[model samples]
Target: MNIRPIEINDYSRWFDLWQAYLAFYTVELSDEVTQKVWERLMNEDDKDLYGLVCEDEDHVIGFTHYFFHGTTWFDSSYCYLEDLFVEQSVRARGAGRALINGVKEQAQTHGAAKLYWHTDKQNETAQGLYNKVADLTDFIRYDIALKP
Candidate 1:
């Protein structure tokens, strides 16, 4: 598998993977939001956001989207791994690990203070893989919807 930063020509392939990811989470995103996310990932001036693609010779099999942000507790920015997904057919083939490691390498190279992500409590499959590669934090996530 080849891991690389998403390029301008990868829109369709990237969108397919993004849709699969949303499907896994049982969510639907509108075209406007999807287009905006693509624009943000590809924006040259936005150093904080990025998308990485994992592909084989003939297909895009996985993707990850991440971003960095400042935090009050640390001087260096923290890396938030916002999304990760591998095609159902390609699971357990190391594509997921490659995409995650790709992000880790980027964080290290760019001097990020930390890298972290969250998975639904019911996602045991993902947790199985994650446990092997990263620590399982005890923190519980809380969210407030500012928009209806």
Candidate 2:
């Protein structure tokens, strides 16, 4: 599988897959929100926000979106694997693995101290794959959206 940065040309089908991804997470975001995410993915000033696409011939089987986050915990930086998905029909076919390995390779090349991300508690299929590659962090995550 070949993995590379996502391009604007990938928008249409990629957005469809992203919508499916949100549905899987039970997120009720609108298409406008997704469009903004696509913009962020392509933001020229933020080159560190990146995505890896797994494809063969003409088919895009999977994608992984990630970003580099500066952290006080590390002298270097960390790669946050924010979203990763393999099409339902292509699950377990190494698509996810290829994307993950690509991100790891990028982090290593950038001298990142680590790569990490969270998964939903009920995502056993992803956990099975993650178990082979990463250790879960002991910390819990919380967020508060800012509103006026």
Which predicted model would earn the best TM-score? 1
Worst 10-residue stretch by lDDT in candidate 2? Answer: 48-57
lDDT of 2 by residue, 32-142 (tens): 877777888899896757887888666787788888888999799988899998888878988888899999998898889999999999999999999998887789989
TM-score of each: 0.95, 0.91
**Would you list the clashing residue pairs of candidate 1?**
none
- Model 1 alpha-carbon drift over 4 Å, by segment: none
lDDT of 1 by residue, 39-125 (tens): 999899856579898998858888899998888888898889999999899899898899999999998887889999999999999
When summed lDDT is taken over every stretch of 10 residues in candidate 1, the lowest stretch is 44-53
Clashes in predicted model 2? 0
Task: Please state every model's RMSD to the true fold in angstroms.
Answer: 1.2, 1.6
Give the poorly placed runs of model 2, Cα more than 4 Å off. none
